[model samples]
Target: MGLEADDSSSPGETVMVVMDANRSRGNVHAIEWALRHVARRGHTVLVLGLLCEIGKRASCFPFHMGEKLERLGEGEVDPTELEEEIARKRDEYKSCLQPFYRHCKKNEVKLESKIAAGLCPRKVTVDEAQSCNTCWIILDSHLKKDKTYIYAHVCCNLALVKGKDVVTLMPSKVILQKSSLKHRRVDDALLSNEPITDDQEEKSITPPPKTCCWYPLAWRTGFPRYFTQSELEVITSGFSEENIVQTQDNVKVYQGQFQETPVLVNCFSQNDERFWSMLRILSRVRHRNILNIVGYCFTGSSMFLLFDFPFMGTLEINLQNDDLAEKILWKARWYIAVEIGACLRYLHEQCVDGLIVHLSVCSSNVIYPLGGSAMLANFMTAKCLKDGSPGDNQSLTHCLNLQEDDGIAIDVHDYGIFLLELITGRSARCSLDPDKEDLIDWALPAIEKGSLSEVRDPRLTDTTDDRLIHHMAQAALLCLQDLNRRISMSEVLAVVRGHEIARPGC
Candidate 1:
């Protein structure tokens, strides 16, 4: 009953059951239940298994040297070996579906198995769902809200199947329970046919009354919690000076623990409106390159925003630390550059609402977590253009007070400067002499003359690849162009990936 091709069955409806192959056993059982329900209704089921290989998507840049170095300690890949690996993956996917095939055969149900590999699995799933006359899509309930939003719009009907345990654990029921069963002894509940004596009735004890605790509606919805002043004080130890990691005019950032989770608390004493606006923007954005906002609090004239603290600190800090600088390999530096470019691309293009402009795209705002890539943070100055509205070209130009192409071009300019810093292993503010304080001015001419070695940092001389060094320098020069001539973040990414080249007015 396994159909590999399109089914022209006009008599029955089609049910698409999407599952992640990497999910736990419980999720597999949930998928089985969904399949049984659809089959019982005399409909055909299409089970799509998503193969999500970390850092192996089509859009991902292949780090051949890094992979080979990790596996063989330094070697080149053989073409035949790579082909064998791909064939092995295909065989493994087929083996994974053997149990599903057998189940469909035993139940006399028609089933089709498909394997999808891509950068965005949800996009692939949506494409598959639209390929046929699909009536309904049954997906796992463990998907994030942003991931599931598209499925609802693309499919005719979508049903989320949850595990039994998840469905049974009702938070309201647990919070509203009136009595505790632990308080009563087993013998106290026993009933006998014989009449009860006065002594037995007097000896019987009355159970203690139950207490009811109230929780806010926000707690149930998954929106940021409205934390009380007392709770904030307790978490940050009354905003102790020792806990403070950074302090600026009217603002202080403290490293604190909330509900046993490490969090960064930013206490602001001014510009409350701006803080709330930033919070709204952060709440709408969900991406790996962006910092995760846990929650926020507003009390009287003071405001606080919570974020998941990055253990390794900011990219600026790492660049300044000689010990850490030596550990950041050439491959890691290239990966970090690409990641920052991707973040800017998401803010400027991929957002569903409209475009977002990060007014500040400097290295100080780039945080390096416990991962190979970097994340962009500090969105206090970000601006967004809502859908269905005219472009904010004037506002963007006025904000930056520059004759740039737009707000996005300003980001490209800042990111270009960041790339220069990454390549030269020097701060953007670092100067070889008094007059050459600006890195862009000092390095642009050299990069234009193809003197990459002269501009590159001496620290990276031993490990740097000349080709990559040249490409990065060329991209940096492109980013430093005039307002109307600078390239977009997407174009910068394309050039960095070697898919495109930079040319003026192209």
Candidate 2:
């Protein structure tokens, strides 16, 4: 059994817990003792129990173990049948636990239960825990092991497992009823019917403290355990407006540091919750061209993120600020393409969620480093598309409406904008008289007439890479077609890589 605490829990406050249902009644007795100790301290308790063991079958199967027997004689069935069964069992389990649920409800002791099917239990648990104010997890001492994999039996993969104070129930050492489950260690002053005052927050239980390991070079992947507001304040010197670089859409960027390492502080408002949610999801991903989030701070009304500083700034800045454009020579342009393409590939193939659309993938969102390399940043507008079809036009409508759908069409549209910048050396949006604006529309006439020269950047006169430019422009124009006919990121990458300029290290 293990316990977790929010910043404010009293030492003896009761905590909500989750456990596997298969555990013996004796095990439940031990957990009861632990819960009593927690409750005496003034906090309430809740428990969630699983009702089924879910596993994937080669072809397909049903959800409920009991009901699945009916389909056992059959070789296989539709995958949807399996999913439907799982959903049905989950509902039935909820009904079966209604008695306990009602008892807990009447006593003000919150409790929940459900069944989930997936190869990654830890991931599923983490997603669920994030939605609750769960304080701890109590699991059987039996260590579920498979070869080198040791399943995290408690807290599953919920971020709470990162808490330093996590308590583990060692099978050999713990005797549930035999040992004294003392309630003396808990403090009672923190619990109150009244809302928690701002002053009382500091004393609230801080997520168990964590040790940080600093590095000069960025790690390929991994997120910091905790990013406290105080630590960030100290690093940014109170985030004085002098350090402020930019602010838009509820996101504020400030300059800061950890020792000599330059960093950018991202502050967001309530409307920007989706951005933070996207970050939490993306934190699990890693790629050379995708800017990695170092740490994050989430407090009521105030949310901030920390990331490594890039010397070269964003592509938007380079396009608008003439002086910066000179620095982005042909070689730098090639590197950006390679890196961004690699990022798209990783997001498409490596992530379990399938496709990731950079809802706002204009040049402005790509950042370049002075030393070299480029990264795709600002995913607040990004979306995860389960099925990898980029030609689904409705995807754009979904993003605009804040609904869920395959965002491949959105990605193709953004790629078209990126192509325009590469060819015209201009922003995706026109600054020319507003009436004459719109890059896609402005270039459409020339592109359709086959007048490639009218759309080519004059600066490429001496570039031996003209053909490379031509091919990219063609690909870009093709992607600009109707959503039903737009090419996929995979196909676009192939055309870009076909250019001689994109040759290794070019």
Candidate 3:
């Protein structure tokens, strides 16, 4: 069993306790005693039971018998029977753990249980211990071969419990100091119910002190600051609907104030693996054109990413409103387009690690901050091109050569659509006319034929500069080229800038 003491005086330090479902009653009793002791100290317990003998399937099958059975339609294994076997094994483990569950409930201990199948108990236990951030491990002294391996590999305090009362302590050298002997002796006394002297009692009542290196590590690391669950709850006002700004797929964006500064909170459900991966990516990336992560929270299974709130909201909202669209003058529109292009270029070429593709680069995902340049948001769908991970909605055709610049060509395609929307003042997916629902299909031909006047927004014709309109249309056309012939962002930026310079101006 693995047990962790929180470095802080906080009560919620997670303690991982590894147990074998098939262990002897004596070993089980000793582990139970250790769990109760830790639970009373205000640490949460995570019990992981190894199912060593279950889930073994035959490696080899007789070809002739298998063929005969397949031909007769009677050789196939029943799925129901396979499920029943798994259920039976799970039930057996659950039954053995019933007493521990009842004990935790009786003592009001925060406890969780998991069953894992593996032949190597040491490897399984070590992996679980590391993942759970275990501060301590309690093992049965009967463990012979795996004991030394677990001791050397697991980065935590180790203890071996034999019979009813024998406990051997091996503290982690990296975490404990020579002075820790006093703390160890005090812990032993507490476990043995020995009367404590005045000095020892005073030490015990004091808050558990944080180690020296903890502060430096947290300060130097460029990782997002970890916020506690309580802080998040208070900031989001218990995640009430009134605080919600937007919802994308399973993620909810809530508006909250942090230290009197407005912030946007992106909450992801426990089951979303993307949340963890995105955190890693966000830590490494910081750019003026990309929305930055202010902080993050990991409480149990749920995750929340805090970002600087975009007070002006999304580009889509502006595009759909006539008054807002008027405020976005020719220069502002051109600036927005150029800024978004720069953002994509930075993601693809300038990131420290490797190329990143913002798969969902549509109008809705582009945010216009109150006093800043337009920036890209919603990186949940973003992927590092170096990893060759496909975007959520990308097809086989679109994902071709993702490690190369061509892999980001699909994003170029989407950006082209954004340009078309900017020029025509039409939604990419919807339009007032049913016949013109898809902007690309309806406008691409006109745009390619240099018929800028025909596809330009009627609302923009009188107010926008004619030269700027023609230049943006031409650039959008270049971005919408055939997949094999599409222009790069560098080239598109050059063309757009060339037009701006060539126009008559002071």
Candidate 3 ranges with C-alpha deviation above 4 Å: 1-224, 387-403, 431-435, 462-464, 499-506
lDDT of predicted model 2: 0.52
Candidate with maximal lDDT: 3
Can you write out model 1's per-residue Cα lDDT over 468-505, one digit (the tens) per residue? 56566667877886556846788887776556787656
lDDT of 1 at 263: 75
lDDT of 3 by residue, 1-506 (tens): 22343242235555665566555332564456456444554566765555454334211111111122111212234445533443554566556666777777776666665555434576567766766657667776555334445654555666566445555455553444335654565344324422323111011111123343211111122325888878888888998899998897989989887666577788999757677657656766755466767788877678888887777788888888998887777766766777788778877876646688887888888886544467788887777666444444411223223556565787887888888878877777685468655788778889777787778776664653666666677677667756667456766665555433221111
lDDT of 2 by residue, 347-451 (tens): 765565455666777788898643355678887866655533343342122333333334666676777678778677788756455765778887756866778
lDDT of each prediction vs. the true structure?
0.59, 0.52, 0.61
Error of 3 at 153 (Å): 41
Best of the candidates, TM-score: 1
* TM-score against truth, every candidate: 0.58, 0.52, 0.51
